[model samples]
Target chain A: MKFSRKTLGIPYGVFLTLFVVAPMIVLFYYAFTNGQGVFTLRNLTDFFTDPNTLGTLFYSLAIALTTTVVCLLIAYPVAYILATSKLKAKSVIIMIFVTPMWINFSLRITALKEILTLIEGNLAYYPFLNSVLGMTYDFLPFMILPIYNTIVKLDHSLTEAARDLGANERGAFLKVTVPLSLPGVVSGISMVFLPAMTNYVVLDMLYNSTYIMGSLIGSYFAAYNWHGGSMIALVLLGIICVFTLLTDSGEDDARTGGALL
Target chain B: MKKFRRILVPVLVLLFLYVPILMLALYSFTDSTQIGAIRSFTFKNYETLFTTDELRSMIVGTLLLALGSAVLATLLGTLGAVGAFYSKKRTSSIMSTVNQIPVINADVVTGFSLCILLVVVFGIPKDTYIPLVIGHVTLCAPFVYLSVIPKLKQMDPALYEAALDLGAKPRTALMKVVIPQILSGMVTGFMLAITLSLDDYFIATYTKPATFDTISTYVVNATKGSQTDIKTALWALSTLIFVLVIVLVLVMNLNSKKREQKEAKA
Candidate 1:
């Protein structure tokens, strides 16, 4: 007996539609409806109007943005050095940075929490700071990996060409290397920022507070406030979609710029 | 100055990464009752962890979920990848885009939304391993799908055609010629799925039954109100996991290197 490739894809299509697409539909249904299942926009309105909820959204965005910036500042230099260095054990060193990831991140964060406590004595007094540090620590590798991948795959002659064109080392790096690596930086920012926005474990572990969008959703779910939780999640889904679209447009710009070059 | 910085920066970053983990590992061996104070070195944390009921169940439950999800995801995903590879171009493109939803969506949203589906929409009871496994499979299968599709693209089209021309059945041609070509991708996908599933906390937390607990959720629960003993036991578990991973990675690297050398000689 023979089976067509389209037939082979049927099982997967069914699985995806049932599990992924259907569940999302359910999420939206819950987001818009009240306890009686009547359609309503109150959930959405309540989310935007509630000061605490709005504050949590702001906090989530602020912290995620800061974490992205910190990760970029730290990771760019590290990834640059790793990519350009003549070190013999470069792969081994890169592996070192990656291996900690295999260890459960929550465990790493817990270890970090312990160290922070020992250093400062009162992490509670600095919840935002601790959460930022934890977010940066937890996500720095994510930022590094994408940027490293791009930098390593970069055309060496691009830099050489810039230098050949009478550009100094600093100018060559700033003009050529930075532009070429923008895609990776953009991707790294998206990866880090999206997760950091929803990462309640780091916040909960560091601050024991539900101050971010993720923590807020988690608390609502924990309390069986399904309507509230789903609404927040839907809003987050919209935000993430817009965020990805913006970053993806930047990537398109980079691609066009590279093509022009 | 440049030479000094190249070494110094990496060393500093590495220290930042490893110091806490090493310290935690060190603390795991010590009798640390208070949060920051280690009094004496001992193996009691491990001993207690090994004997405890809740911790034992948590470990078993975690492994069960990880393994079950990894295996199921790999099977479904490999099939999906194969299907995608041979399907029409337009259909394949659409499938691939839809598949990335879970990968890009926030973990919190995925977990919460799925929880809604299982509990409210489907009316499945909350807090069972079934939902957790299903949730994890959903999370992991996409990774396998993405990984395997690339290998399939890279495979030689002639191999399968040749097998078919040699009078092999379609299934035989697929199993014999195509599967072997994509075995590495499948293996990579399986490993990736396991790692992703094992490290997950958010999806597991929302999807899991109240009685069930993965290592992540257990640690989170223990850390609530700062249960020192449970936290230390987790550190011991972390040390064990860290050592196992290091050993496994090293062995894999060595084996691959040996294989490469053999290939070069041939």
Candidate 2:
């Protein structure tokens, strides 16, 4: 629909301005300014001094990494299965994986904690494994979808060509399918990796924050430490921006490039 | 022989992927009744969920969160899609990419940042619905934008041109002509957003007011409480939701088949 420039520009301008752009500027500004409204580096310095806050950055990353590796290991086979098999009801399998994902994420995590508690006393019964499993269950979809998409797109002829050569079954898969599905691997792992590293909610829900980064921020907020919270977010945002820049995951292009469509 | 291996590998993978969810649903039924000797049969757990006031309220709250976020997300997403459509600059590409990040970003990180957005920067009181909605919408709107923008891009300029030529107002053209063509895409985005909003947890924990709760939270709380009735209800409820989702998906698939048949006939 054609319209006056104002009609077209004004509405979205307000939205982006108010919601996206404005808050971002305010957050960065809030990070620098103190309670008296003068500029200071205290918040940034304080972020570094607190072991709990600073330590969470790594804790968060470790969680994401652990989840990514596990998810990739599990998802790759499933992706390959979906890509290779002519099984009836492929959509059914897909639906089952996605169904829980559609239910309340918080609820699933909540349920997970319940299940863990029943399985053992509390996750304290098996702290490390519990956290990993918690992450694995929740973020499995992120790892699966992109890899599945990638596996589906892999050139099947390559596997055939590899077989025609002297390569054994394992070699053919390793040399052909794995390499060919690199984009999906790249995309899927990238999807899994970044979020896994940043995620602390699963850790919070399943474990008692015995060792987690996200929980620190949660507690800080709970304690009414706005200045410290903004500083933490600003730091995380900077790290994310850099990571996005380096990987150039092209996720934006893929989604809008008619991947899901 | 190679083909057989291919078939075997995929079947195993399918089993692996689909097993945990099925198991979770199964265990939910048995959690309470099968007390000793591996008691695997009973609906007592499900009974507790339905009977408990807290569980009932949580279910309602989760449904409300999903519904509210999905509606707001779909509306904002449509606007973002429209904005993306009109965007001739490289900025749309960047925005779309940035928009896509939250969908894949660690929920914990987004929840953390959103906490900052609401409780810290805006001085929004902690443990309120506003933060909950904002957290959900931030995550959900991008999916809607991703879903709707492509359809909007594919619209025929001629249809719009004709409407304008016939003296239809800009708003009318968008409402009557543009929306019809893009309705399916919009619907897809809305469904996605609904699911996403429903799926949220990380944000709920952070932003949810101290006393506030949801289906997910209740399950977690109950597990921590006694590992009994409330937990089973959550399982039944999650199963119910899954069943409903499966049915809805089947219906949509059938509807799409019918549409394709009609199109082919036409």
Candidate 3:
């Protein structure tokens, strides 16, 4: 039907105002108002000075980068397989991988914790490794689905063109399909990297609050260190906000990173 | 010979993904008080898990929370998506980003922020389902929105045109035309929302206490502090989860095959 824009505009505005703008305003209020609205930068300043907090910051970046690289290595091969193989039950393979997506994240983390604890009851060695692996497993479906979607959308005719012009299989596949799917890679990387960097609970549960970003903030909250927690929150949010903004700018064609959200 | 590479690719990929998960599934069966006791298999853990009321309730509670959060989030998110579908570019961007923030923002940050906001700012009671549901809905909304938008975008405007041309009212056109086109998006979104709510122990911890011990929380506690029986109980739970996941995968695959066949017919 021929509806006017006003019909949709008001409802949409109310949704955004309540959910998006209002919460952020509350966030900023809590960030600045240390029990009495003096509007100070104390939280931001304290975040930089604290060594333990800073250490966790470094750990988060290191873990996120490592997680992204490992996920790429693992997911690339899988995407390549789903792209190339003419298997009749390719949908079955997709279902198998996506099945993990359906399993509760907490359960998966708990399961990983079980296996790791079984392997080494002690903490100090590889909880970080386990955490990284857990994040990878949890987010792998996110990584694979987008890249696979890109591959499916790719023009196989390019490979035919490359092969006709005398390039070998490796050269054709790489030179053709891989480069063209960079948009998917961009989408996939941001998709995996953002949450992986931010998520610390998997580490917390598995490593018993080993002080990654997720756990660090969690610990502060548990301790009622609202100022300290918000301090860390500001820093983490600052690091991620640029990413949030980049993605917010409507990179619609770049990647559908919301494969499973 | 080159086709060998194509054949081998899938096998290798499957091994990479499944090997660790399989190892996890296996360890769920073997005894774990000897923590890494790989050889000894027993049904003792299963007996204990099945017998425990706390464990059973945690399972049920977690499922209920997951189902509630997913369903509610999808409902709201679907509303937001439909609303956004008719909004201007700028407004839609803001809404989608807002929808997205919960998913991308760190669980800790969101959890911490939400707890403070709910208790300190909004003056809500501490550790209630209200807070937990709000926190989860914030996270789950984007997932639903994300899943729905692509299908919504891909949907042909022609159907809406036809419905309207047939003199259907706006609501009727949406119900008859737009809704059917994006139903898969809604389904996928629902599935994703449920999955996320299930995985979320972090926010739940901040908002809800041990009174809300989920499977993840239960498993976490079970692993610590020289607790052999608890650990055995955890192993049983893990095996159950693994088997359940395998069955789910099979069902999903079958569903997808049917969809593909129906699409082929269409």
Q: Which candidate is the best by TM-score?
A: 1
TM-score of every model versus the real structure: 0.95, 0.84, 0.86
TM-score of chain A of each: 0.92, 0.86, 0.86
DockQ for each model: 0.49, 0.34, 0.43
In the range B84-111, model 2's lDDT, one tens digit per residue, is: 6767667577666556557555566567
Model 3 pairs whose backbones collide = A105-B199, A106-B199
Each prediction's fraction of true contacts recovered: 0.66, 0.30, 0.40
* Top-scoring candidate (DockQ): 1
CA lDDT of every candidate: 0.84, 0.68, 0.71
Q: Which stretches of candidate 3 lie over 4 Å from their true place?
A: A1-16, A110-123, A126-131, A168-170, A205-210, A244-261, B1-16, B27-42, B88-90, B154-173
Instruction: Tell me the docking grade of candidate 2.
Output: acceptable
Write model 3 residue lDDT over B39-86, tens digit each, in one string: 677677777787878878888988998899888877777777877877
Instruction: Give the clash count for each candidate.
Output: 3, 11, 2
Poorest lDDT segment (10 consecutive residues) of candidate 3 chain B = B30-39
User: What is the lDDT, from 0 to 100, of the residue B251 in candidate 2?
Assistant: 77
